[model samples]
Target: MQRPNYPSGKDLLSADAVSRFDLDDIMERAERHLREEEMEKAGHALPEPPAPRRRPKVIATLFDQRSTRTRLGFQAAAARLGHQSIDAYDTDRNRIGQTTGESIEDHIHTVELYSDLLVVRSHMEDLPYRVGRLSYLPVINAGNGADEHPSQALVDIFAIRQMRGPIETLGIALSSDTRARFAISFVKMLKLSPPKRFTLCCLPDAPLNPAMREAMTVLANLGTAIGIVHDIRQTLDHDVLSIQMQDMSKFAHAALGNEAVDKEKESEPFTLTARKILDARSDTLILNPLPRFSELDTSCDSLPNAGYFRQVQLSVPMRMAILERMLLGIPWTGQADSFPPSSGG
Candidate 1:
């Protein structure tokens, strides 16, 4: 076929048309609309329930990484929306490690034939984006590498917004090995005028992983005040903290380059002590992505301002929105057509 005469190169907006259209930006706007709809659903409008859309679909939950709450949240969200969820085991279950290298694109294509949406948690960061581009169905990034956990980030942001209202100015204290991974998700959440500050509290010897360093640079350019501190004492200045502490005893020899007196002595307190810091801020929000060891004191849970439990609760509604978007292709915009005519309500 002969190509028609095209507009002159000078008339083109830019060399990269894809740059003009960002998938993440679109998804972020959609998320905001859904959140508002959820709020309306929970408000005084609750006496008349909104008619649920009938979109029968199947969601594939592919996990190559360890997950507890994430798996359950996605499953529950799918069920609530009357969708089927298929749990796919690791690639090792198939012959990927054998004769033919099962490429991500191939694996996604095969799964897309069976399911309407793909929710994947992989050990490699690039895998999700690769599959999203190749797959016909919507691809949700559950957790990727030590990189982004978009769902977790969304839920966390929802929790913060619920507790503190809009996050035009906010503070977050993130600690430990997974900081960089969570950082990617958190930075996107900072689109609400960007966080006033983000403090990293790590052990003096523990350096942030490479991915985290890159995330910090990116966030800094976006007007977020990023700081790395070796002590939690510095974090007391911040109002909210989402903490993750790690035991470095295993890598102590290599990373620390120190032959400690005793292994027993190495078992120092990894948990945050709140008794002293509690007085620092009148209304402090403490969050630990659970399964915490000594990183967070249990007694602090009883405090009046403790919002960690609230964070976990917010995950349900957030996940519901995500499943609706990815599996059922529900529009996130709160436009009139997004929901059926509401006489039933």
Candidate 2:
């Protein structure tokens, strides 16, 4: 396939990398893919698959953390696109993390030669950036230590747009850890299409993550009516509420095996329940990136407000769109012209 020329780089390391135009393009592609699937499922005739690539593209996943959805979603998306994925990092079998392991430079050099694109998830905040600098292949940051999950943000925006309506007309609330990677990416990506009202429901005592603060500042400057509230109830009037656990550091540490998992209950003020939704008489759509903790009550599962499961369903086509665009050499032009260096937060 012939490649398209775009000034933006091939790597999607941060939500900052996607421009409004890039986001629209991606969403259009995802919607098209989704429509075709729905049509096929309805027993409608569809065009035949294109001829296979002589050298099918390889997507290399280097996840140094545990996952369920993101991992399988990308692998499945690749298969649908006639591509394959390789687990590039294996702590037990690979020399990368051994006592006398090869340097990251050496490891990436070898991995880049074998793969056409790299999707990275790491506990280290800068690992993806480091890999992006080292590899010629397109790099997608699956998730990074309290940094950002840009793709998840894309999935989320796509979900909201699909389920609710245009984002610009919506009142969106995020009830999550201020440092959560997905939250950071979500807010950052929102700068592309600022919502009418953006409210944050977080712990009253905790300071906002610097990365999140900066991203929100961008949205505020874009004319989004930004508000910060301590209770989830305060956000119930919004059209959508994207939620997650409050303290991500505890989970991050547990994922790194540095400590036992924290099983502490979510704070009452932050938790969202069906009763609360009913009592408030609000019809806010609820969204959670799963492996959900107590913050999202199961009581809300059957409620009309629940949209996380549908969010997961929408992720497949989004992933397919991302892979298809990058594989076609279309660069993301969503980044600001005067982009500053990431502090690795």
Candidate 3:
């Protein structure tokens, strides 16, 4: 069968799609938007006003999983861009996945007709890929099942840049589940602006995740000094440390009643606390994709190093930048025609 002729607009399906040039452009746009917002907040009139669009664009969000940040972030971004948004999929109102429902093809075709862009978040890893193949409308993979949350990674990088400084000069550490979608995307995206030193603080005895291992190898090849340590303390000396709960698969399986929750406290060794930072007298800028669990202790909230809340705030402009760029039909220059098997997630 012949492949459908996709539109010139790009789909941001993976961090690997973004190039250093793309990153620079997006970051510049985001910084400009943030400055404009700050100026407006200070009651300063702009020297040049935003040109109104001939017709307001519509952004359709097809999220099969629960979300608080990604959904609102895009909606806010669309509104800021003088566009509209619609929740394209609602299990309560839509029948796309029901026995009596329309097929995904029919649903996507209908959505593409109504919207200019499609933002997808699903527990199914392949949903965004399937949608990208099925529809000509540009698709943004909000989050896929333990696969890649590329947009969130962009937000994270933006936060780090804004809070710390240039990406290439910093020593960065990630304390997370090796299989985490965000972690995978984070490490992959780092290749565009390789850090001075990159560290992975994860389980000691467990073998590295294939996807993560591949991403780290790319960074290593790029001359990033990569280290793997069992304890979070080993990473405390780094300029920035991004952290999340470990072994999400175990928690997910437990939640689904597939198996008993492991009584073993694996996270203790990896958890970050204010006490540790204070005792070490470290100045590491701490970041977390929120809805944080026990992995990030609340005691760290008052510390100057805690940047997660600010990280959340920075996501708005970054999201706006993404929508703005994609709407212009600019494709990511670095995207491969086909991703390698090891980079699937």
- Give me the candidate number with maximum TM-score: 2
Candidate 3 C-alpha lDDT tens digits along 122-191:
8777888888878887899998888899999999999999999999999999998898888999999999
Candidate 1, residues 1-345: lDDT per residue as tens digits?
Answer: 332332111110111111112223434644554565576777735434547758568878877766778888788777766677898656446544456666554666678778877787776556665655555566667766655665676677767766775555777777665444554566544543457787777767766666566656766887888898766656766767777655433321222113332322222334566674575654667776665556667777788767777777677767776665444343222111121122320
True-vs-predicted CA distance for residue 158, candidate 3, Å:
0.7
For model 3, the stretches where C-alpha displacement exceeds 4 angstroms are: 1-4, 250-266, 339-345
Candidate 3 TM-score over all chains jointly: 0.92
Error of 2 at 118 (Å): 0.5
* lDDT for position 187 in model 3: 95
Which residue pairs clash within candidate 3? none
Query: In order, what is each prediction's RMSD in angstroms?
Result: 10.9, 3.4, 3.4
Global CA lDDT of candidate 2, please?
0.89
Clashing pairs in model 2, backbone N/Cα/C closer than 3 A: 18-334, 19-334
Candidate 2 is scored at a TM of 0.93
Q: Which candidate is the best by lDDT?
A: 2
Candidates 2 and 3: which is better by TM-score? Answer: 2
Candidate 2: Cα lDDT at 35: 87
TM-score: which is higher, 1 or 3? 3
**TM-score of every candidate relative to the true structure:** 0.70, 0.93, 0.92
Q: Which candidate order results from sorting by TM-score in descending order? A: 2, 3, 1
